[model samples]
Target: MSVKGVTPIENTLEINWQGDQKSIYHNIWLRDNCHCSECYYPITKQRLLNSATIDINIKPKSVNVKEGKVEIVWDTDHSSTYDVDWLRIHSYNPRLIPLDKKLKDDDDVLKQKLWQVKDIKDDLPQVDYNKIMQSSDETDNEEAIKEWLLQIHKFGFSLINNVPISPTDTEKLCEKLNYIRPTHYGGFWDFTADLSKNDTAYTNFDISNHTDGTYWSNSPGLQLFHLLYHDGKGGTTSLVDSFKCAEILKAKYPESYEIFCKIPVPAHSAGEPKVCIQPDIPQPIFKLDHQGKLIQVRWNQSDRSTMDYWENPEDVIKFYKAIKNWVEIITSPENELWYQMKPGQCLIFDNWRIFHSRSEFTGQRRLCGAYFERDDFISRLKLLTLGREAVLDSI
Candidate 1:
């Protein structure tokens, strides 16, 4: 977007774009967004000026536009320049962006493509571990890693093949994400069915489909599972797309879905004697944003501590019915995806939208993996999916 001309009217700058489109920017908005060294710190890219201190009626004394840039000299003798692409991306003019497309400041920008059991059967996202490790730059010439991350973003999971079946290579692969999220079990875990931690994950029980870290306020976002060794029989892993299940429940059992969305479920982690973990604020099984878009799905009956949240006995009955329906939808044989993970296969999935479980097994088994902070993982995804400049434009 190149600026063709600018007109100041009633303390607002109206920019006439080269493509016959125009945008309106208030004087106060421009004055508050000065990009000078004193006004904005370049290294941090954070504003140094307090927006509240700027005068609301501030006007620019002069305006200049040249070479896809806009320059303005304000009445306070402050000068600022803006890249036209930034202005186009942040344009608030109704001509450019409709009311329905307007996004809240904190709303998630990534779009999702929900999947089913048969959707990815023949072409499940699988990336070569060697190709991902060959590239040092995560953002450039790394389509393999980007596609792997994109699959997780779109379908909630991706499998990385031939990971060398060792903690060292797994740790190196995770470090490419920048950091590992430490948990009650610790960071960069390597354990077998020795019950090192006091959790169901430490046993060879037939664990039902559930999301991990339901007991914490901010649960782990990305969970990596690498089957290093498992010679025993009858321990196949399964995953269910909880987002898809939620939609099915909403369509089939509207009442139960509403109850699950509105009601809160309490969960606690009391495995460790001195380390009890619980969420300060209880969350619903189906979490939605202000726009009613599903943002999270927290369903873990194993970790649920008590059902004492509601006072109405009828609500309790409805919740029970809801959970029953929810369980059926998630556990249905048609919806579940069973996999016999091989020794060199590594499965990384989104903990927020995917439910994982394992069937009971015999003999010894060893696995190694790590947890990733949601922000850190998404940061890499955004950068890899969209280049630095594109990310800035989207913001």
Candidate 2:
């Protein structure tokens, strides 16, 4: 294709193309898929797309393709002409392809996001353990605590040791952690003798590999737990990097990955005063992070019984089986890090990215749990550093 002249008249692009009449103008396509902040949200976070108001009807008026360059004119009076070379670089086909399928020019964005969790190393910000340890009893260390929490914000999780062992202390620790309990009970999973003893009030059985609070319309983003009494017996906490698990599944079972991407799993909780029913979250078991890195995995077999109801029952079965196997591979001792929480130690993790569970304990063991909205942490960090909250809510 050859372009004779290229010019931007006002906001419209003027382009001449010398190609078969059947060939759709390429510049027009580029204008429609512009990824610029003006065309789309600056932060292309998956959740942000729901809030975006895009003008999908807008189209380009004309296009011209020359030996080396192409020009595009927009139909809107205020639109701008774009160069063909630039258009080609940013164009993307909107067709929903399976996570395993590679689009024409896009790299596996999901894979790229997934691998980021594995590759994160020293580049992540760190908290000064000494400073936190030296804080006095009288001074308000909220500033210091905010600094420590910011490190956890940068890293998916962080650990603190030597907290005073008391229920009051546990509550205070959660407050310092900026805990924003879910409006519903979705955020807190109480591990108390009262709840555990009452089988009807709480399900005290062993929990399988899964993320928490999937039944909530808006699940808590961060989970915090403080060990009040370990008694030095059992109940070691185990955490698996869900992102790593996702990539392993994607590589080993491409068919299962495709099945999960296509199927919608139902998640709900019933027989309670506050019951929750979520019909289809439209989320991949694995998802890419803000930087286009895959770092989140949402899988809970107990809540996944709805998978069998999918239109493609066989595919759902295959996906369930694949995920079951994948969970086993990822949660194995070799792939996970297990830490026995001494009395008074606390653990906090990103709910969306990490899957945590504990081995059954024989004797009495107690732990206090709390959760904070994702934006709370972000706001705390921004306020600590910028002296004011960014006001940008919702991750």
Candidate 3:
């Protein structure tokens, strides 16, 4: 973390660490990140100096390692000091390929531990409700909440044991991040397996494993479902880590994987008598970030709209084949994990990464659940898990 030396390049600053390791920081990046009280506000974690005002070609008059800090005197007569640890964490080496750019921000995405059914069958991440909600100390509660949420970030889903079997308790859990996201289904909602709506979810038939809200451009990021009551048999909840399935596809069927990643498929939900819901534009089944790392999985075969928008029948066939390949991976025994939710058990999952399903049942199954917006949940996680400086940098 201690800087051994600093060398000012033409448009960058190179730092040699205590060991043989070295890193390069762009001149503009350094200037924009000058975290001094004059240039940045600690409380808001916002830059007081506008980035657009900084010259693109600005150079440093002198760069030195002083008192374990990188001190830079810019040609503009402004000076900035950077802690070596922050500089090291924010270093860039200009990787060209998408795969090589995966670690650009040392965020949760980089630390994800992808897994299949075997990894979670017995040891599914679960937390005690009392620990998170009834802790006497605020720090203890914060740590408990972080533990409850970090599970979803790392493995895509988690279970809360002994959550009060009340509809409002589910809303309370959702509020741990911020607030429940409202959909066509009401906010802070509860539903029973009755002919309440037009969707098949109102029936007793088995539901396939799929991520919800594929029809929306910006789908809900997190989903919580608590089984408030299940008087009859079956209705075991099933979950699959689509991220893990995707990795297998990348290794086994690269061509098909690429098709899923590139081809946009339209989806819709016209079950409601008065309203029709669909994304503004079609979206790829396998969504990836610029780094070529998978971010979300949109897989709802039943919600897929007709292919009239796609003119090429050959392309349509290829898309079907790609989808079939992905389906095979997710349906495999080793990929699916099933659990029977009791009245007091609540499940929270990252909708972007996990596919959830339900088994056929005879009796009425009452459920209460809510959705958490993607950015809110992620920011909450970062606030709980990452250092203030790192969180501020991301902001």
Candidate 2 vs candidate 3: the TM-score winner is 3
Give per-model TM-scores: 0.88, 0.60, 0.87
Which 10 consecutive residues of model 1 have the lowest summed lDDT?
Answer: 98-107
Sort by lDDT, best first. Answer: 1, 3, 2
Q: Candidate 1: lDDT of 29?
A: 82
Please count the clashing residue pairs in each candidate, in the order shown: 0, 15, 0
Worst 10 residues of 3 by lDDT: 94-103
**lDDT of each model, Cα atoms only?**
0.83, 0.56, 0.82
For all predictions, the C-alpha RMSD in Å is: 3.6, 9.5, 3.7
Evaluate model 2: give its lDDT.
Answer: 0.56
Candidate closest to the true structure, highest TM-score: 1
Q: TM-score of the candidate numbered 2? A: 0.60
Ranking by TM-score: 1, 3, 2
What is the C-alpha lDDT profile of model 3 across 82-126, one tens digit per residue? 877666656667422222233344544437778987777878899
